[model samples]
Target: MSRKLDPRVVRTRQMLRDALVELIHEQGYEKITVQDITSRATLNRATFYLHYRDKLDLLYQSSKEIVKDLTECIDLSFEEDKEFDFLSDKPHIVFIRLFEQVSQNSNLYKVFLTEKNMPHFTSRIKDVLVDFILKGINHVQPDDQLLTVPREIAVRYFAAAFLEVIVWWLEKDMPYAPKYMAGLLMRIAIKGPYVNNPF
Candidate 1:
């Protein structure tokens, strides 16, 4: 009750993702079509639809694939056997790896980081960050009810803040070094909001 795709299937999917990425760089995501992607990728229209529903699906899959790879490469879940301040270091280290990924392939990440019209990535980012926040919170406060309104405010704001900061960093014409920016990001994220809120 299983299936393994042929090697060609793997290569074809990669081709589509790569082609779509190139096309996105040349033109905005809104302007891209399935036909355009397939043509550039040297595959047929049927092949394109068989693999991806549309340009947006291709884009989402590509971003997920890239981030999953980055996540796997980094050891974010180190054991805290000693007082090494890994909590403080976590986001900064992740930021370094994330932005280093961007630096290596800026064009690809630009498409991944902020393609405003695409809602798929919006959900993906929220899901990833929410999970991250829950993990950190559970580790620190295992008995707390995370679903409460007060808790949601902090988790939601924290994730949104991190994403906005990252997007701003990426969109900058002169990119900051990811390691330094990561440290700065982690500091604020761990510290929570600066101004008071009556929530």
Candidate 2:
């Protein structure tokens, strides 16, 4: 069984996370000291240490939380046998929601994604996406250049594509809104036959 977190503990951690997000936007992660975070959070060094091992550890915690929330919003079961278009809509909507949250503090996310810590965040997202795709499309076997790729391969491809798109968006100062991006990315990722299958 899992233990429930204390309300006070949860609140304190969120405060620290909020502070860290704010601080990262103003300066590089390498340049932002622990003292800066503690000061911004209005908490002491001991309190910061109690919640996280260090700055890097806090970043991991933030990434883990985002991934967990994202995975939860996804429904793994599809007993109704959804149409491909139906499947496309789900990702577009879900990703838009995540993107909206990211847009709240774009600069913070920009710093996080481009920094050395990217691999940690990228890997966590890839693992979740892999598990989601592998379970949903377990038997996707194409017979052309769109070959019979394994579920793991599909996940990796999806994750890689999304990461590239996201990095570009961040670098571009996020010229488009989340809804526009959701639609555009859906077009790129909606899987289908290599040959025309407009049935």
Candidate 3:
């Protein structure tokens, strides 16, 4: 059995998270403190202590929520489909939705992802992508004997490529629309590396 968190508590935590992200952008993650977060959130120290022990605790929880939203963004786009349609434009649709999620929350991602001292947050996102890709690979090709490359290496390669594109997108302030970026990623995913593609 499980219990739902109070709505007030949930709202408070989100406010704190948003405040922390704002402060992180202004100063940096390593320099921000719990007091700074609470002050920016317009809440007091006692209220902050009631929810999180410290700034780092808030950071981990905030980053986890972002990753959860990203996972749900991708998952909800394909919940009705039991089988993947490789021949169809399904990859583009899914990637567009995923990128839309990031663009919608671009500020938080721009700060946490680009920050120098936030490797933990970045790694958590990569871990999510790696797990998602690994599961898909296993589902599509269940037989290990048929694999040309080690499963771990292949999965990491795909995950790193996806992560790098996302970072680049953020760095460039998402000059390309989500759908356009999705099409590019889908092509690379289906046709191997960009250099080998006929396009």
Candidate that scores best on TM-score: 3
lDDT of 1: 0.68
Please, what are the lDDT tens digits per residue for candidate 3 over residues 1-199?
A: 7799999999999899899989999998888888889899999999999998899889888888899998877764343455757656546456788789889889888888899999988998899888767766676677878888888998999899999999999999999988888877776766666555475
Clashing pairs in 2: none
Worst 10 residues of 3 by lDDT: 75-84
TM-score of model 2 vs. true structure: 0.70
lDDT of 1 by residue, 1-199 (tens): 6598799988998899889888877887878899898899999999888888887778778878866665554435422323436356454344566556656656566666676666666567666766666655555555556434566677788778767776677678436776777677766666544645557
Compose the digit string of candidate 2's lDDT tens values, residues 45-152. 999999899998888898788777767765435444445454454444455665665576576567667777467776776677667555545433323355466555
Task: Give the TM-score of each candidate.
Answer: 0.68, 0.70, 0.83
Taken over the whole model, the C-alpha lDDT of each candidate is 0.68, 0.70, 0.83
Which parts of model 2 have CA positions greater than 4 angstroms off? 1-4, 78-108, 139-154, 191-199
- Which ranges of candidate 3 are over 4 A from the true structure? 75-84, 89-93, 143-147, 193-199
Ten residues in a row with the worst lDDT in model 1?
Answer: 75-84
